[model samples]
Target: MESSFQSENENSFNIYLKDISKFKPLKREEEHDLIIHVKKGDKAAMKKLIEANLRFVVSVASNYRNQGMPLADLVNEGNIGLIRSAKRFDETKNFKFISYAVWWIRQAILQAMSEQSRIMKLPLNRVSTIHNVGKVVSKLEQKLKRFPTCDEIAKHLKIDEGDVREAFAIGSGHSSLDSPFSNEDDGSLLDLIENEQAPSPDDKIDGYFLGNEIEDLLNTLKRREAEVLRLYYGIDCERSHTLEEIAAKYNLTRERIRQIKERAIKRLKHPSRNTSLRKFHQG
Candidate 1:
């Protein structure tokens, strides 16, 4: 008898498995190339740009780039932005984190300027209001897919329009991270960023339902191969057994066990066999 998927998570898990099934197994040579690319410093590009920006405004990097702020002060303010960007970056978004973070880094620099010049400080309460306003803007930006106007933000925060305008006045316009919230004991706006990683109730319930379909696929392999994989990969075992341990248990040489492990891996990599187990890997 055929069984139907009982819940939405089951269906979602199935789709994720299909995506896994489409993965092409990497060859040893291809793996080396990937390592070489990463080693060649593609990942350091963002860090380099951040360093370059620090030497300029020393506070923020924007149209007002040559404010001649002290290098020590500039690095401090710029790094605050860098840390904030890492905290708030949404990996699933289509754009790069740096593009979204440009304003964050720049805003921190601007605040450094305001502090250095001893500009008029907003009252603590007003600073709190600005922080509240910034939170709404960040939320609404994601929801609306564009920067929300002051009126839109005001409505969302249920605060007055004048208050929103005051927050914007601190910068040439696009400033948010400059708000003076006493987030940590050090008094940074850094604490205002929200954490978005909690899984939903449905995801928790769905997590419990994974694994059955994968077990069914493993059942199709030769008994020895399937059992070996179950132990080697820790599919249903206490923990993954090393190839040598598995060899001793099976009364086989370590080299033979390794060959079996590799061959089984290649077999699982085949699109037809892999697609069968995609449902198992979904969780």
Candidate 2:
């Protein structure tokens, strides 16, 4: 039964590949029309748009194969992004659909990878921010002919020094705990480290108490501000959303969304408003 299942999977994958290959990519005019139809809720147009872009999704997904996820899974995630792009595509913008869709595609794939590939999963916004920081670092390195310092990178990226440091720390890939210590025949690194499973009883009590405290604090803000902060931080949701996404949901511009978020953060950071949350600011 296992052998038969494997054979069937291989055949299915081959068929999918063949179908994608037959879907010649849409030209600019053709894409515009299909996008119009998609906006009008045409299922056939939506399907065709996605099918025509499956190969593009595959191409993009291939770039992430080394991130410890299967190529097929990455492509599946990319296809989800592609479908989202189809629904959100703005023909009035006059930009190519592929150009707009690429961001969505990469975002979905990276979100999936961050959740699946790590035992210590970082928030989706942090993962995205780290990738953005890396891109800035690479460009700066090419221009300056050396590795950039945290302060320099922070200045270039227009983010805080602490944020840059955190990004670098989290983006550093994990290593096996069983790896040898140096080139010597000494015991593995795992032998030197102690593993702690669940949180302590005191810690659990503190965490529960703090969670209620934070939720109460969140209620102090206006409804829109509170919702924006919760969604941005994923305080109660599965994942944080990008500013652009929040902007779309609110029917506002990205800049407007950023302004609202910044204002919300400022309100939260006010000493009088968040006096009980002082521990959050302490190291």
- The candidate that achieves the highest lDDT relative to the unseen native structure: 2
Top candidate, metric TM-score: 2
Query: What is the C-alpha local distance difference test score of candidate 1?
Result: 0.51
* lDDT for each residue of candidate 2 in 1-283, tens digit (9 for 90 to 100): 9999868876887788887899987766687899999989999999989998899899989998877876778889999978967876656642357755765677678667765655257677797778878788768866874446667888987889878766754453211112232233333322221113222232112123233444666777789988876666445443455555678889999899777866765665565665554443231
Off by over 4 Å in 2: 1-11, 118-283
> How many angstroms is residue 139 displaced in model 2 relative to the true structure, after the best TM-score fit?
38
Give per-residue CA lDDT, model 1, range 164-274, as digits (tens). 776655422432322221122222122212113332222123232223444565676778877876766445442345556678899999899877765654555456764
User: In candidate 1, where is summed lDDT lowest over 10 consecutive residues?
Assistant: 186-195
TM-score of every candidate: 0.32, 0.43
Q: Model 1, 213: alpha-carbon shift in Å?
A: 57
